[model samples]
Target: MTQSKSIAILIADDDAEDRMLLREAMEENHLPNELFFVENGEELMDFLCHRGNYADKEGYPLPGLILLDLNMPKKDGREALKEIKEDVNLKHIPVVVLTTSKAEEDILKTYDLGVSSFITKPVTFASLVEMIKTLADYWFDLVELPKNPKL
Candidate 1:
């Protein structure tokens, strides 16, 4: 895989406000990566598998990294993470659990399920901006990720 193509950051979150906040945080941090949103785990899976609306590869490019929210209406992040990790085509993408849950069980379970990291959503917007900056720094600048050939 080549790193020349632009890769998006796929985010799965049920809350509209949270998604909006994340987008604003990304903007504040100057994270230029394209961002995609899925309301639930089922939609996230659909997007990754290139099913339904996500079949248009050019419009919905495969994400290099996933920002998953654990709690959702259907199929939650735990199930989505399991499916992504189990799938051969999608397993290479790094998944980071970004959620409001600070539960020990959620953190431990996500890590055990092969999540790259589990981060609790910061309450303040400034903190979120910093978190997004750090995340961008690590994933975009520091690490070399597999680029999607289909893009």
Candidate 2:
């Protein structure tokens, strides 16, 4: 297994406000990690595959973790998660489903599709900040993540 010392997170979401809010949450909590954003699954795929507009390393380094939203244009998280988990080169990257949906079927399906965790997006900014902080504390500060093995 191999990996980078600097932790990186890729957030795939279509909502502009939500993206800004998430960034603010991390900033408020004093969380220091590289953050990448994609508005849709197609953009995310380009970023991950180093294709088209995302070919540069600064624009598209493989992320350590992915925070995915369920619904969006071009492609959705469910579709993206399935493709990612199926890809031999990309399957090892831990993905956490962060969405507004609390539907039981969505929850079960995401987990079954190999999402590492599933979290419902909270309404308030304060709650969301807490969520991100807790996630950072656990995933980055506490839990020992598997070293990304390059195939």
Candidate 3:
């Protein structure tokens, strides 16, 4: 269950501006991968679970990496992380916490919940782009992610 190759990166953030910025950064960095977006944790879970509209597997492929934002409406990232880590099939996917909060408690909590990494959202667009490059380099280049079992 060895998605070593560059696979789709799913982002679950409530902020439209943040999502747009992330997309722009990925594009600016020329990351050759698909980018999927979910507005909140509920939507994120729905996407991952392939429920309802996401029932079509081909249309919504399993993500190799998940960039999860900590705070969101309707089932926050913490809850989503708990569910994902508890599930046998979904636990394999790498979940990186990318959020604006730099609280130690949040960090500790997410790490304890089994998040692969926790990244503080950069304020500036340039800084964000740099972060995205580094993230792409690490996850897509250096690290070998767990293979997508659903694939």
The most accurate candidate by lDDT is 3
lDDT of 3 by residue, 6-107 (tens): 599899999999999999999898787888999988998899999987888888988999999999999999999999999898999999999999999999
Candidate 2 lDDT over residue span 1-151, tens digit each: 1222367889999999999999999888877778999999998888888789888866577888899999989999999999999988789888999999999999999999999999999999999999998888778877777665642
lDDT tens digits, residue span 1-151, model 1? 1231366899999999999999999888766678999999999999998899899887888898999999998899999999999988898899999999999999999999899999999999999999998888788877898766553
Local distance difference test scores for all models? 0.89, 0.87, 0.90
Poorest 10 consecutive residues by lDDT, candidate 1: 1-10
User: Which sections of candidate 3 miss by over 4 Å?
Assistant: 1-6
Number of the candidate with higher lDDT, 1 or 3: 3
Error of 2 at 89 (Å): 1.3
Better of 1 and 2 by TM-score: 1
Instruction: Return the TM-score for each candidate structure.
Output: 0.93, 0.92, 0.95
Lowest lDDT sum, 10 consecutive residues, model 3, at 1-10
Steric overlap count per candidate: 0, 0, 2
Rank the candidate models, highest lDDT first: 3, 1, 2
Which residue runs does candidate 2 get wrong by more than 4 Å?
1-5, 149-151
The CA lDDT at 23 in model 1 is: 98
| Model 1 accuracy (lDDT, Cα) | 0.89
Stretches of model 1 off by over 4 angstroms after superposition: 1-5, 149-151
In candidate 3, residue 129 scores what lDDT?
95
lDDT of 1 at 132: 90
